[model samples]
Target: MKDPANPTSRTPEDDRLRRRIGPTIRDVARMANVSIGTVSKALNNNGSLKAETRERVIAVANALGFRPNSLAQSLHRRHSFTVGLISNDSFGRFTMPIAEGLEACLADRQIAVFMCNATDDPERERQHVEQLLGKRVDGMVITARRADRRPGLDGALRGLPVIYVFSQSDDPEAVCLLPDDEGGARMAVEHLIGLGRQRIAHITGPERFEAVRLRRDGYRQALTAAGLAEGEGYYLSGDWSEKWGYDAAARLFAHGREPPDALFCGNDQIARGAADALRERGIAVPEDVAIVGFDNWNVMTEASRPPLTSVDLNLRALGREAGRRLIAMIDGTPMRGVSRLPCTLVIRESCGAKTDTLTGTEDYA
Candidate 1:
């Protein structure tokens, strides 16, 4: 019973369904009174057009809810617009921040990131690398939980642009981004010296680690610079754990031996353990023994008795820099050598620094 003059009158639901389908380039061209080619040029900023004409076309496209097809655009540009992120950090302690920073930098460029965790398995890592290669990613970023040097992926990479983060490759020409651990350790020791504490002991991880050696060298350099000598039992090397720190602290004070007035721990967990040990032995923090830690981990630093003052590795910034360098490398720019970014010292009650009332956080770069 449809009337000839008003056959199939549109309903609100019909209009809503039509809107969900979205507007096309042809719709935009018709509304803007321009050709489809002109609309494409305006959207991509590709061809000669007057500024006023470009603005008008763009305004029409925006009003119509027009969106370009990313897959088609990528095909036209001959790029997959994707990057691969490979990590051996199964805990995500170091990988998360770096990934966030990298994503932040690449978001504006419409690049997608594929993350793969290879754990400690060589076969798994190889499989992940092969998959990423099959996808034809524009570039790749490799990171690890530790800051040690790892074997390069020379055979697998096939000349793809790659950057290392929080770790280095054994390859001499590989680009690496890491925190300045030596400089950070020196700053911590110097701060303790400035606080009038002469006997500064270093409690660190195993001697096999390059970081441990570098930090120890920095601690020794600071002590020597201030005309202070390291006593027989001032440097202790053990496993990187709270239990190790607790045991080390007890050994330092046993047998009526002189105790260090300040303790510079390799990590926050060790510093917290040492603090607990000192508390049980009836020693007041800052008044009798001050403590400084590394890593600036919020869980350990903020939960400690006086809140630890520790070195921040600036991992996120390192990731951002890595992303920039990778982009440049993908664009045919050559990058080489290692780059060490400076760390910042977050000041809190642990280091005897007064906290800022407004922010409750202060740092020294």
Candidate 2:
């Protein structure tokens, strides 16, 4: 839903273009039996028009799909009314819904979005940034994998009101919007604890990524809070993909020591692969070895034979918030650094066992 306080929806320019095509003020005035000036006043809310006549004109305009030329209006006012978006390759899938939600919210405010996929390449990202600047976008938002560490971004956007979405690096100067990774990790681990699995192993993404690092931290925190010392051998690092998940799971299963009673995968893709590996080894999920994943990516998790337990990172919210913040920055309102959105746990059949069954699994940090 579009927040009323900030009406900055996705692609404000596109929506305006849709409205500008038909039913000019002349047409509306003709239909309402009023002067074009009256119709203009009614549409723009600029000057006084008879209330009854205004209603009639509005009604006619509505029937005829008459819309104001927001792009032209913003141009006349010396505002680009456009936001630049730079995203990474993996996070690209999330851009659409977020963009859609943003557009829906910003409909009344009249703003538009310009998007670019940087594919995690510094040079390409730099080029895209330059292109957006050339286009005179009013503000910019980036769904960066490494918000602070990206080369040239800091210097390039020094004076621009830029907001980072999805991930943030260690630098404090970056204004960012991200999921509550710690909270999400805690939610997933606690769900496993609740399911009575004590010997839990984690297959995590590359430590270089901030979100992954936080999720790993959250897992350790959860284990510590429960009085369990996390095993040194319990963690496996891998790429955020199903192939890596499968490889890690196989490695764990083959390692001679007692197999972990459960697994916490870094993301849904890894979890899916882990599940396949377990199934291939004839291990029944939840009943034998439980599994939990991050990122509530619905395609695989929701449709799996036995649905997977996962965490919802609120990625769409992250996108929408980024858009809202970008609009604010363009409007000369600087937002606070580091805005975080809460994530929720989604339970399924993956962790079905009772919590008390795992005797040695208490308080591992």
Per-prediction TM-score to the true structure, in the order listed? 0.83, 0.76
lDDT of 1 at 84: 94
How many residue pairs clash (N, CA or C atoms closer than 3 angstroms) in each of the candidate models, in the order given?
A: 0, 19
lDDT of 2 by residue, 208-266 (tens): 77778888888998898887778767899879888998999998888567888899988
Local error of candidate 2 at residue 200 (angstroms): 0.5
For model 1, what is the C-alpha lDDT against the true structure?
0.86
Q: What is the lDDT of residue 213 in candidate 2?
A: 82
For model 1, state the Cα shift of residue 38 in Å.
5.1
| Candidate 1 structure quality by residue, lDDT tens digits, 277-309 | 998999888789999998888999999998988
Stretches of candidate 1 off by over 4 Å are: 1-39, 48-67, 108-110, 356-365
